[model samples]
Target: MATSKDGVKLDKSTPESVWKQILSAEEYHILRQKGTERAGTGIYNKFYEDGVYKCAGCGTPLYKSETKFNSGCGWPAFYDEIPGAVERHVDNTYGMRRVEITCANCGGHLGHVFEGEGFPTPTNQRHCVNSVSVKFEPKQ
Candidate 1:
């Protein structure tokens, strides 16, 4: 299994049965199958608590809560990520062109990121992420 820069063991090459045993059905679909949850229906769509967001598949830290913003796009939106936390791909599925973002460590699907929108972020990018693809660790 591949590991992330932060030493999180990736779940790649694990059996489907093993993944099914560890992750919820929704989580597997989003993180492994690259399926997206419906808009405005994600648990983190409106959640803005202070903490870090980690990849559900490997527990690698992805984004700090301070980078999250309300994009009104339904899913959790982040303007930035922890350095080297994710990889990018070109996605042309569903007749739309998008940049697909995945966990750099385990290669789990996090979601898509878009650019050129006029958002008040340092990068002017919006990471449209799936709630099922991540787990939240609250700050003390």
Candidate 2:
């Protein structure tokens, strides 16, 4: 299992400060407090170049450019994530049961994952990621 920059284990359990230092106020609210950004209001929503998307909080590789698809969910959508790079938990915070996706390394929330997308992918999973949770590294 890959560890974070500060050596935090890439699992669901991690220290709070590890998350705090790596993320900003808005990032913390969305990733840790389960706050949602308004749809179609993220910078990455307009990104259309080729690149890999990584966790902004910990620099962990999350999604590849190839796996990205136009889901029209008003956020960056991907069909898959890097192997063993994320962890999911059942979130019941907002009076609904949803799988909350987080960075495996630092426990920073990326977004949610859902099934039955009917996309042309093996998993048929749609990872609705927050643009604030990720940064794109454009391919040269």
Candidate 3:
């Protein structure tokens, strides 16, 4: 098991083919091909239950319920991620510069992180994630 910078255990050995088999086509597209879900259509976009959002690809815990906020951006928005659970990359696709966030463990695409939008959150960074990229686990 690989661990993130904060020592959170991660699994990186799962083969991509296995992921392809495990995920639906939509999930594979969003999580593997970096595709985005249509705005306002995500299951989690309006859900506010207390839970942890895990990467749909590898089940790595990514965000907590407290970090979630309605950014009105038509996606499930989080002000932050579970420390070291996600990683950032420079994405220049679609003729725009953006910071892409992914599962640090499985390298699955979650979405983009936008900063300085002034969302009244501690980080002020909006994690614009695809709903198909995460699965919610209610607090137990």
Candidate 4:
């Protein structure tokens, strides 16, 4: 296991077969297959807590609670991710150009990121995350 910049352990769990054992069907769909949950149905959609949001696949800390904000985009929205915790890629899978975000460690899909939406955030970006892709750890 390799550790990330923040000292979060980055397990090299890869390939579909390996994840099928650790994640449930729902989690595997979103994190492994790069699928998205229905809007407004994620557990973190309306959740506002002071904690760290970690990648469900590799337990790498991805987002800080303070970066979370309600964008009313029907998903968990954050303005920023923990430094070096997430990776972005130009995604054109569905014929729509979007930047897809994934865990830097395990390469698990988190969600897409949108920029310049004119939100009241410092970064003016929305990191739309799938609740199934992450787990929350409340700040102690």
Candidate 5:
């Protein structure tokens, strides 16, 4: 397996069959197929601990626990990313226009970002992320 710049193992080049075998059904759905976990059902929805969140698909570090907050959006929410860890794209699916967030290294679909919500953050932005798209690592 190849590793990304942040030292995360990447399986983006792996075949779909291999991915299905390696990942859980929910993880494969959200991370590889660009699907979304249901509202309020994500493991990290109410989780708050000191750690880092890594991409489930490629293991790339994406967000710090400090950046996480309870937005009550029924998913893990972040005010910011670990700079350069993610990329943004214009999503026009489902008859809506939104910014899609993805892992910078493996291009795994993370979730979406919204602004102008007046969150108590420097950027005043909300990065609504799917719990299945990430794995949390507590600080040692």
Candidate 6:
């Protein structure tokens, strides 16, 4: 494992080797290829426990339990992210305007962030993340 600048542990190996060692074909397809999983099928969809959500590829703390909210979007949604923990890029794929979110330390695709969610929170942001991109560590 390689620790990135933000202390996220990313697989330092080549993409092929990392693909072979760290992920299955399906996982690779969804995470590496930027494919979307069927909504409501992800393990994190209903996770309401208090915990820190880390990047699956690189164990960087991304979201805190306090920031999580039910966006009813079938994905694990968060109103905010750990400061400086993620990076956003403009995505022009599929002919849709989207903001691509990635682990700031490792450049791994986590998901996308959207605005105008109309949540009561001041940020009014929704970070719709893929379950496979995150691992939860329950708070004690």
**lDDT (C-alpha, whole model) for all candidates:** 0.89, 0.82, 0.89, 0.90, 0.88, 0.81
Best by lDDT: 4
Off by over 4 Å in 3: 1-10
**lDDT of candidate model 5 versus the reference:** 0.88
Report how far off residue 77 is in candidate 2 (Å): 0.4
Cα lDDT tens digits for candidate 3, 8-84: 44456766676676779999899888899999999999999998999887778899999999999999999989999
Reference-based TM-score of each model: 0.90, 0.82, 0.90, 0.91, 0.89, 0.86
Error of 2 at 140 (Å): 3.6
* Candidate 2 lDDT tens digits, 1-140: 54667676644465667677766899879877777789999888657789889887767888988888778889888888999888889988769898999888767778899899698877899999999989899997
Candidate 3 lowest-lDDT run of ten: 1-10
> How would you encode candidate 6's per-residue C-alpha lDDT over 1-140 as one tens digit per residue?
45545553465343545554666666666657777778999999889999899887667899999998888999999988999998899999989999999878666678899998688876999999999888899998
Q: Which candidate should be chosen as best, given TM-score against the real structure?
A: 4
Clash pairs detected, candidate 3: none
In candidate 4, stretches whose alpha carbon ends up further than 4 angstroms from where it belongs are 1-13
Candidate 1 to truth, TM: 0.90
lDDT of 4 by residue, 1-140 (tens): 54444554546545567677767999989998899999999999999989999999888899999999999999999999999999999998878999999998899999999999999899999999999999999999
Q: Report the C-alpha lDDT of model 1 over 95-134, residue by residue, as the tens digit.
A: 9999999998777899999999999999999999999999
The superposed Cα distance between candidate 1 and the true structure at residue 98, in angstroms, equals 0.6
Q: Write out the backbone clash pairs for model 5.
A: none
- Using TM-score as the yardstick, the better of models 3 and 6 is 3
